[model samples]
Target: MKFAPERSSVALFVALTRAVREAPVAEGGRSLAYDVIDRLAKVINTPGFKVELEALIALGAREPVLNSALEPFWQELHMLSSSSSAGSA
Candidate 1:
């Protein structure tokens, strides 16, 4: 079944967050959460997914009052995805 980009993207993010929260954390949970988030993102295996999420991350960063602890995760996602896309092309 084909899904709208926005719907698929939002569902991916929601799944990522749920996976991150349920993940085991031995130390700083934020970093562990980031790792889980990164893994979850990679599972999508589509550059469009990364681009959509990256846009959301950028938007969130612009919100001064929105404390989105996703900078590191977003950066890692960007690097992995962009590099993979380049390699594929």
Candidate 2:
């Protein structure tokens, strides 16, 4: 079944988060979560990526479960974006 953008976004986020968390450690004993989050923070600052990220966050805000689940990452992205823009200013 085809899902709406918001629904798909939520699902994708959930899946990625779970997969990253479950991924076996290579050598550092660290999960992919940190790397993923760091990359995501940078991606969110790009024009197209920023738009997509904002769309997902806006939809998440209206969906209770996703909103809460995505809160920390969303907040971090926003903080990073703000700092990045400020630095460029």
Candidate 3:
């Protein structure tokens, strides 16, 4: 099934989060860990997964396979919550 752009973005964000979280902390890899953490923080605070996607793209993610591999739960939540908020407003 095809997903909206926002949904695709969020799925990618969640996949990235899981990958980072599952990655083993290597010895003498504090810098790498910190970088990953920073990226995670930025992604989490981003208004939408598109921003996270753009960031990934800027980081040289050009392969269709790689892009397709990332999930889009971020976009899903953004849409769901935003719609709920709008309804409440």
Best by TM-score: 2
Worst 10 residues of 3 by lDDT: 60-69
For model 1, the superposed segments whose C-alpha errors exceed 4 Å read 1-43, 65-68
lDDT of 3 by residue, 1-89 (tens): 87555444456455565644444433333334335435644545344434543554433244333333333333553454455445554
**Clashing residue pairs in candidate 1 (N, C-alpha, C atoms within 3 angstroms):** none
lDDT tens digits, residue span 1-89, model 1: 65334435456467556544554433355454455456545655555545655554544455422224443245545665676566656
Superposition error at 62 for model 3 (Å): 0.4
* Residue-level error in angstroms, candidate 3, position 52: 4.3
Residue 2 lDDT in candidate 1: 56
RMSD after Cα superposition, model 3:
7.8
- CA lDDT of each candidate? 0.51, 0.49, 0.44
lDDT of 2 at 42: 48
Per-candidate clash tally: 0, 0, 10
**Runs with alpha carbons beyond 4 Å of true place in candidate 2:** 1-16, 19-45, 83-89
lDDT (tens digit, per residue) of candidate 2 on 1-89: 55333333345456547644554434232233444444554464454455545655654555445455555456545654565556555
